[model samples]
Target: MDMRRTGAIEAVSDGGTVESIATKMGNSIDQNKTLQKTYMLVNLASVHAADESRKIGRKNIASQQNEIKS
Candidate 1:
């Protein structure tokens, strides 16, 4: 859950940052495209991190069960 929260924070922070950068770009087509790409990547990373955290949490439970079998 902590990882998910962190990722959510990071994703929101990056979105705000991109908005700031876009406002500054004004009329720069090249920069706007770059910023859009960055936004996509950052959000994608946040989503993946959250998913991995869930998988890790499940794996931990599996590990604990395996320990009891020994």
Candidate 2:
């Protein structure tokens, strides 16, 4: 979405008249579905990163506990 907004603005400005501007804007909005998918993928990646971090943290805590026991 952020990437699209920047590109859309440039496209609209380059077109410069009412009809051309509207056409560019409409095209930009239509392209938003791709951006939506990209956003979803990024969120999924973040969830994976967090899950991995939690597993690592738990393992480290267990290792510390074992060291203390010895």
Candidate 3:
């Protein structure tokens, strides 16, 4: 993955063809993009789950406090 685009860029900079660069790097670049998106989604889901757990804990504490007051 790292080798694909960087190598392509280097090749072009060194006077290689632009015509096949995309063909050479396309699949790896796409895989990298998909991986990035998947990581982002997993991170978001983890954060959301953590926040929901915190909310539920706070609600339980509030109910317990009200019970003691009564």
RMSD of each: 7.7, 10.7, 12.6
Worst 10 residues of 3 by lDDT: 35-44
How large an RMSD does model 2 have? 10.7
Each model's lDDT comes to 0.58, 0.56, 0.58
How far residue 69's Cα lies from its native spot in candidate 3, in Å, is 0.8
- Please count the clashing residue pairs in each candidate, in the order shown: 0, 0, 0
lDDT by residue (tens digit), candidate 1, 1-70: 3543344346566664544444544534235665455443446667789999999999999999999998
lDDT of 3 by residue, 1-70 (tens): 5655456546555665544454565544334656334322334457679989999999999999999999
Candidate 2, which ten residues in sequence have the lowest lDDT sum?
A: 35-44
lDDT for each residue of candidate 2 in 1-70, tens digit (9 for 90 to 100): 6665555445544653334533645654334566434322334457679989999999999999999999
Against the hidden reference, what TM-scores do the models get? Answer: 0.33, 0.40, 0.39
